[model samples]
Target: MNLDRSIDDYLAHVRTERGYSEHTVAAYRSDLVDLAGFASGRGVEGVAGIDLALLRDWLWTATERGLARTTIARRAASARGWTAWLHRRGLIAADPGLRLKAPRAQRTLPRVVAERALADALAALADRAAGDDPVAVRDAAIAELLYASALRVSELVGLDLADVDRRRRTVRVTGKGSKERVVPYGAPAARALDRYLEVARPAILAGVAEHGKNAGGAAAPTAVFLGVRGGRLGVRSVHRQIAAMLSSIPGAGPSGPHALRHSAATHLLDGGADLRAVQEFLGHASLGTTQIYTHVSAERLKQSYRTAHPRA
Candidate 1:
């Protein structure tokens, strides 16, 4: 079969059977497309033409082009998975990528804001939310819930009104793999959510009603977060909002919603939350993935000791 057709089938399998998120599937598609282009350039236009040596050369070319180690590593993984799938489906005589390898990507710790700094920042947002403005109210609630639950930005924006249980202080979120998990939020988030629901959400809905732009008559949006146009809030808009908020605060790291998540996880560990529980709270499938926060906590301890020990 053609390599491009095989790649499309693999992507469909991952998206439908494996239940990988849209973002993850897009990434895999991108990597495979790049490999297919390289293979076609070298007159290797079929699945049978891919071999261990060609795979190695592809990665070597990427390295020669000065791509980041992470990108190269992901490309290698994409190739490996695709070849394995082909072998399993009897589309290939053998798995050519069984011997494939790439340089390990460096693991940099996630950026975490100090507890005091985060507190001050949220407090300032809450103060701005004191008025009856809908956008300000929504922003405050978003910041509070993000820090309180350590939720991914996708999970946050995917939230619907029916998913939140204000009385229980819990939210039902569909995480990666379309897996549903109930995560609890703190008092600040609850308070902010309540205010937004009572004051801001209805106001926005009323605007939508006035404009007669409801997508469906009775089947209108039930999303917990809404844009200025009263449609479901999108991921890019959330990123932009978080970036604008983080730009003013003094911190080092990627200025996005994930910084709040990292800070929340690190804070939980510093407060003595168990590793296993934190893993569940963050909805991580693997314990190894959750172990990174321990390193963050240890690094914090070392920094404290360096500043206050004074025994040199």
Candidate 2:
């Protein structure tokens, strides 16, 4: 059968015989539709005539358009799954996408705030709080813990009544890929957190009412940060606040919550922390992923070299 005919038959089979949900069927349909467009652009008319080279060419075309590495990887997986289904059903007799490799994009070095500038931003938060805003107090604690432990904003907000150990100065964090790691902070972060828990959390929750999102509680049970509505703090609010604060500081390139995580990693490496130890602390799945921070160090070296080398 031709590509379009085979896809129509596969959709029906998956929905009725395989008991696939409508959403799953829809996703499959969309992926196949895009694949068909890609194949047409390659001058291949049907599934039976498709080859692995055509699949590679399609992905190369996407790379030329600057599709992110993760996006290209997902598209490649989608194509492989479709071709495998076609082969199993005898529509194409083989899977052409099996050998098509997604192009690997280089990992860019993460942008980080300079140590002095990051410290200054935290100091500025105290003035933001002295104006008698509980939300400002909460914001200080939120930003402090985020940078202190390199915590993803979600992990920071997801805490319950039992995640933090004040005595140990540590937090139990659930990281990406469902992995758990404990991260430590220092006295400064601890003091910021203590102030929030004692003074700010109650005030923010007091004006709020019960809702599905009020999972944290009226008294900020265990969340290191709480939304104005007594719910878990969300990524957007934290991001906006951080951006506004960081952009005011020199040496922090534009701003985002992620800058805190990057700054923390880079500073640790600069302070003579072992790369392998930093890898585990950052909870990187691969050491290669953690190695990008070395580039930041190299950039700093180049700056110092240009200034100090005596050769014009």
| Candidate 1: residue 40 Cα off by (Å) | 0.8
Q: Taking the tens digit of each residue's C-alpha lDDT, what string does model 2 give over 1-312? A: 677887788888777877655556777788677778888876767788778888887778878989889778777876887788888877777788778788665566778787888888899997797766899988888889889999877777777658888999998987764578988999988998888887888777666644444555554545667787776777789889998888776663547888898999999998999999999888888998888898898898788899999992
Instruction: Quote model 1's TM-score.
Output: 0.96
TM-score, every prediction: 0.96, 0.74
lDDT of each: 0.92, 0.80
In model 1, which regions exceed 4 Å deviation?
A: 212-220
Number of the top TM-score candidate: 1
Model 1 residue-pair collision total:
0
The local distance difference test score of model 2 is: 0.80
Mind giving the per-residue lDDT tens digits that candidate 1 earns over 1-312?
998999999999999999999999999999999999999999998999999999999999999999999999999999999999999999999999999999999999999988887888888888999997898999999999999999999999989989999999999999999999999999989999999989998888887778865655443379999887788887898888788877877867898999999999999999999999999999999999999999999999998999999882
Residue 111 local lDDT, model 1: 92
| Per-model tally of clashing residue pairs | 0, 1
